[model samples]
Target: MSRPDLFKGIVSVAGGIMLPIDQTLLPLKEKAILIYHGSNDDVIEISKSIQDYNKLKNIGTKNMELKIVKNANHFLSSQTFKDEYLYEWLEKNI
Candidate 1:
């Protein structure tokens, strides 16, 4: 979000922001976002992405999507949505 001009859309998988959701003060409500997280991720808790997604929605973000993958891990060893959905999202957003 620091360099919004360079990014037209965002796709984050098992990723998170350093700051708290309520503390985010940037104008990110309109940025097209695709957030994905594995339910069984051991590296980063899924709550980070969940909370951030909810916070973004509550703050009036419109073009945002969240996918809480089941039976998956930090590296997404059990998920398969990337083959098609990811490309679809990228095609539509980017």
Candidate 2:
């Protein structure tokens, strides 16, 4: 069977697969990166987020926060504390 050409141009790099966020060479200008991933996400693997967070820390990313919500799916429906967390983080950072 032939492979589907899904997200060809958008999710690719120089005719190859795009690297994950931590593996990419792009510079991040944000003062802080708040990544929230569900532990039970069915779409994206939780390992990817953990890897990214570790890589960010290894590369000395300032104010990098990773929150893993338990029992939440891809939409994080089980975790609804984003607003409060965001507000507090923003207040402290900005």
Candidate 3:
């Protein structure tokens, strides 16, 4: 997100925004953002994903989607499911 001009949309999987993001640029950035997190992720807690989502929303992300894969872990064990959703989301956003 450092260079919003380059990316049309952002897809974050098992990732979290640890540092504070400037709201000035974010509020004007209406690009689609997709966040996918595994519920049983041991590496990064799902709560972090949720918090990240909330942060994006609070900062004014218009077209954002958050998906939590059930029974999945940090590795995203269900590749099939992830691929399906990812394919769909990318097609729709990109």
Error of 1 at 19 (Å): 1.7
- lDDT value, residue 68 of candidate 3: 87
Candidate number that wins on lDDT, 1 or 2:
1
Stretches of candidate 1 off by over 4 Å are 21-25, 77-81
**Candidate 1's residue-wise lDDT over 39-78, tens digit each?**
9998999998988888888888899999878878899733
Candidate with the greatest TM-score versus the true structure? 3
**Model 3: CA > 4 A from native:** 23-28, 77-82
Judge candidate 1 against the unseen true structure and give its global Cα lDDT, from 0 to 1. 0.80
- Tens-digit per-residue lDDT, 23-88, candidate 2: 343343233667777778777788777776676666676666777777777776335454487567
Give the C-alpha lDDT of model 2. 0.55
Error of 1 at 93 (Å): 1.0
Candidate number with the higher TM-score (1 or 2): 1
lDDT of each: 0.80, 0.55, 0.79
Measured against the true structure, the TM-scores of the candidates, in listed sequence, are 0.82, 0.62, 0.84
lDDT ranking, high to low: 1, 3, 2
**Against the true structure, candidate 3 has what lDDT?**
0.79
